[model samples]
Target: MYRIPFDRVNWTTSSFLIGTALIALFGLPVYLYHYGANWFLVALFFFYLIATMMSITVGYHRLFSHLAFKAKLPVRVFTLIFGACAFENACLDWASDHRRHHKHVDHDGDPYDISKGFMWAHIGWLMFKLNPEPPMDNVNDLRKDKWVMWQYRYVHWIGLVVGLIIPSALGYAWNAYHGLDPWIGALGGFLIPGIARIVVAQHCTFFINSLCHTVGRQPYSTSHSARDSAVMAFLTFGEGYHNYHHEFQHDYRNGVKAWQWDPSKWTIWTLSKLGLADSLRRVPDSKILLAEMREARRKAELHLEEIRQQQQPGQCQRASDKVHELVEKLAANYHELENAIAERVQLSREALNRWQNETRGIMREISRIQLLTPA
Candidate 1:
């Protein structure tokens, strides 16, 4: 029999996850049965969910892991608290693993390489030390931040207090004031939002690893297992644009197009305006356009080749006609896009947004043209 390596097991994490899961399964249902749907606490669950998830997505993932922008002390502290509440890990640990994931994605060295399978990437990697120890060398910059380090030292206790104790205390007080059993409020507020919320949050974060790789289009680069799923983006607060993310990991925005939903990007932008964020990084439109156009051309060529190898002569001719049309239109689109980007003036945020939308329009038109000559 293969003996369990007890030393290698992250007992603290394993016990917490199992304890919370059992509460979410057994405790939450019991509380709901007794309270008959405390919509108020349910709303609080969602509130905590959004807050903590954003802390991880915007604060930890983007701000800390990628250093996509610089945040003020308050902003950094805010992210650290709620990020701890997310209970994934300390910001240092989380960012280190994530940086490795980016540096060596879809490879054995990738912390959550999707090649291992969906479940493994989503949660199995966390079941044990399946991933190698993340090198601290990758996150030397984050370590320099005092707030990040403070949170690192007290992360577990911070998670318990901010994620559980506080909510439970408030719930108990509210219920006792209303002359109801304090335990009822405690259960609904603490267990549901505290434990259950972690489960839901973990999955939202996990979806970025699993669903992002499994379902979606790779418009920027197919060099890795990443892809952009708009549906997943909405679910994960805009982290689902994995294809663009993998292609341009340093870019501040995953949903680069103006029309896409990316609350995380918007939050960073908003903070900058409020002077709580600064030094926001962005990939120039010219570079983004270049990558998209190249990928489109590659796909078109592959499709044409597949069509050419087929037996149907009539189908072959039709496909050839469509391919030619696609190639011609794509070249035109590329030139127009390049010209627009080159002639751009002092671009304000609104101008930048408008420019992105127009670029997206041209890309969409190219897509329509490609469909006209379907393989």
Candidate 2:
């Protein structure tokens, strides 16, 4: 692959510099002082942090980007507006970059490929000009939607105004109205929760593109750098299961298991039940189990090959026997599970289709009855 000349790239932007400087100077000091030097600020900061993080996870990632689930227009609009507060980017832009990353993962074209280097993958790439021309290909689908286009066009300004400026103004108003010192609210609301939250939120999201690919367990597939890290999930509101996400990008849920720590998935699921969202995508259990089985078998085969190459006859024999036993047990379990899951998925799909047809019929009948009665 041909490399773009570094000298040809424009490496600085006024907005990026201002944003970086504010975070480093004002945001960092406020966070350290409040979190360590003041307890009350810490509590306030954390509360806002959690809420904003969910806006990105539940709103940006699962809902907007992947369309893994369908949300009501009102709910969808709310998410898009608040999601901008994270100051990451517009949902359309963010989603476009993500889709491109998945499409060209591990290749030079992948926007955040860890193979490029940890820093580069995490946030360095943003420092350089990204094709200067608009990303028409990645976001063509979004352009047709006026709301998404509007957000994409003005996300940066909206984020700055609402996420930063408005909060500061509100802080001043409260101080004037209540006769409390405005500095306290300004520092607490604007600096600590607002600016500081952006820094932390951005890093937490970036870590999935960097740290997640660099560390954690790869029980599912070793073909990619993605990994499943519980710690990362906790920090990023359930985005830590990178391996599963990369493997099943279309699935709405990252942590497939009931016990998995995926607050984002839980939020979406609860909202779906309340009719705020619908069409939650999920990978079949059979497919996930089969993938796991295949990986395990691959590992066992490699281990056996190593033992055989070492010329340790007894060890090889014992290892071979163990592998054979394990494989047989796993195969039996896989087949049983697969058969049951396949049947369940088929039945579920049929039931859902029938329900949709019946509901439509009932609605049509009601309309006909009203027409026959005359106004």
Candidate 3:
């Protein structure tokens, strides 16, 4: 177990994290029992939840951290405002840590390195100031953005007012207009939409660092701990395709597939259409396919080698022969696939399609061999 450094404890962050969670846990049930699910309050909570979570995932993570897309002032302002409400940190600090995380992922510099432990990655890192404060020199580009600087100067004030006070005021007004107790309504709003939403939204982001690195499929690359999870995507508004995100960090979309639930990707696309965003970076389909093929080929080769090693000298001659044939086939097809892609600029569409089809068939065969291999 990792020891908590009492002297290194960040009292402010620790208090906020623990206090908000405790209030949400204990206060929410009491609020529900008294108010019996007031629709206005419930709607407010959902509204805050979606806004804050989206701001962090889309704005702080994608726009600021990775520079995945360029946003107009309105989009930037909105994201920064609610992104602050998530209370993760100012854009400058958040982006700085995130850039370091990618530049030195899973190594000493990663702010929330999962190798440390699930709890450490999830929240312990934030609770305690175990490491010395690193300079924000990485965010030189962001430092030029006036809006980001403005938010950095007053993030906590914005968070307190827009995140908590505004919701409470709205709740009070709603109750007053409806001839109900405004005081109770205000308290309910502060507790539910304000505090509880923060706890949930913050955890959703933390899960990307903890659970994303711990479980899920790493089809793209195992070089890093990052993996993809549909459940995490759902919780985080489509930020859960961690494997793909790590593999192609500059791509605007985490969920790279057509059917993947990446609302952040969709939002950026929609913003582009509306002239609110532009310069959305994306990894080409060919490149993505190449990555998949390479990983698949590598896994197949490992499985085949294992099967060959396991085969008795003469007892499993047939299986050994089959493994050799599959290995030859895999190598030949993969080589051809690479050549075809390399000459894609000069190749006709028809020829590329034929090569792709042949490669897919080879991959299917490789998959079968992999499945047959004993765990």
Please, what are the lDDT tens digits per residue for candidate 1 over residues 113-132? Answer: 89988977987678778546
Which regions of candidate 1 deviate over 4 angstroms?
A: 1-9, 311-318, 328-375
C-alpha lDDT values of all predictions: 0.82, 0.72, 0.86
For each candidate in turn, the TM-score is 0.86, 0.79, 0.93
Best by TM-score: 3
Model 3 misplaced regions, further than 4 Å = 344-364, 367-375
Better of 1 and 3 by TM-score: 3
Worst 10-residue lDDT window, candidate 1: 366-375
Tens-place lDDT digits, model 2, residues 1-375: 967557545455436545765775866776567633244445656766776688788888887778888888777777777678787778887888888788888886688878988977887667665545445487676677777777788887878887777666765565666777777666556776677767787788888899889888776798899999899888778999999999998899988777779999998899988989999999875577567755665665565455456544333254445544554555555565566566765435564344334433432332232111111
Please give the lDDT score at residue 233 for candidate 1.
Answer: 96
> Which structure is stronger by TM-score: 1 or 2?
1
Measured on C-alpha atoms, candidate 3 has an lDDT of 0.86
lDDT of 3 by residue, 223-338 (tens): 99998989888987997899999999999999998889998888899999999999999986767766766776677677777777776555535554665676677677667767
